[model samples]
Target: MEAVSYSGLRKNLKHYLQQVNDDATTLLVTNRDNDDTAVVMSKRDYDSMTETLRIMSNPTLIDKIRRGKTQIAKGKTKQHELIEPDD
Candidate 1:
């Protein structure tokens, strides 16, 4: 992550945006005023983070994942045929 002042970000908005997209990094736009901070991130990163949050919010899904991992560790696994969806 990188921190830049609000004015600085405004001055070099294009460069900052390109950097965020190209480097897959986040930018923290800081303001002198209280609690006016903003964050800039690539869409891909944002989507990934949101998806992770959604998954983490589901306890049943997380428990299933943990159980799957434990099953793999214990060598209790089976392979199945892939089911392709009709186009």
Candidate 2:
């Protein structure tokens, strides 16, 4: 793992990309507000993170619609639905 300033990353974008392509290398981007840092890793690691995120994201929309219908059938929902404003 290597830590570089934000300016360094911007200046050596190609070099940083090359390191990112190396599976063993990880980069830390620094010099942002509140001392926050961002990590850059190989595509394999990025894909693994994406898959984990997909698994973690919930099916909230389907659950909400099912609950709404059940509530309506039970007379627990309000009769009036709010209309959205048109742009």
Candidate 3:
């Protein structure tokens, strides 16, 4: 994440917009008078983050993810090809 003042962002809006889109960078806009702040990020990245949050909110899925990480750390994982189902 990159931090920039409101004025700075407005001054270089085009450049920062490119950074957010191309580099998948997040921008934190800060204000002087107030504690208000804003974040800017790509739509794709935002969607991905929301999806991850949705998955994490499920207790069953969270447990499974934790177990998988433990198994990986214990070197109990195997290499296998993932076969997708035909539509």
Q: Best candidate, lDDT-wise?
A: 1
Question: Candidate 2 lDDT, tens digit per residue, 1-87?
Answer: 788998999999998988788655889899768457788888888888887677557577567767889998998966678899999
lDDT of 3 by residue, 13-62 (tens): 99999999999989999998566899999998999999999998999999
Candidate 3 lDDT for residue 46: 97
Top-down TM-score ranking: 1, 3, 2
How accurate locally is residue 64 in candidate 1, as Cα lDDT from 0 to 100? 97
- lDDT, model 1, position 66: 100
Each model's TM-score, in the order given? Answer: 0.83, 0.49, 0.68
Off by over 4 Å in 1: 79-87
lDDT of all predictions: 0.97, 0.82, 0.94
- Residue by residue across 1-87, what tens digits does model 1's lDDT show? 799999999999999999999999999999997599999999999999999999999999999999999999999999999999999
Give the Å error, residue 49, model 2: 3.5
Worst 10 residues of 1 by lDDT: 30-39
Q: Which stretches of candidate 3 lie over 4 Å from their true place?
A: 63-87
The runs of at least 3 residues in candidate 2 whose Cα sits more than 4 Å from the true structure, single-residue gaps closed, are 52-87
The model with the greater lDDT, 1 or 2, is: 1
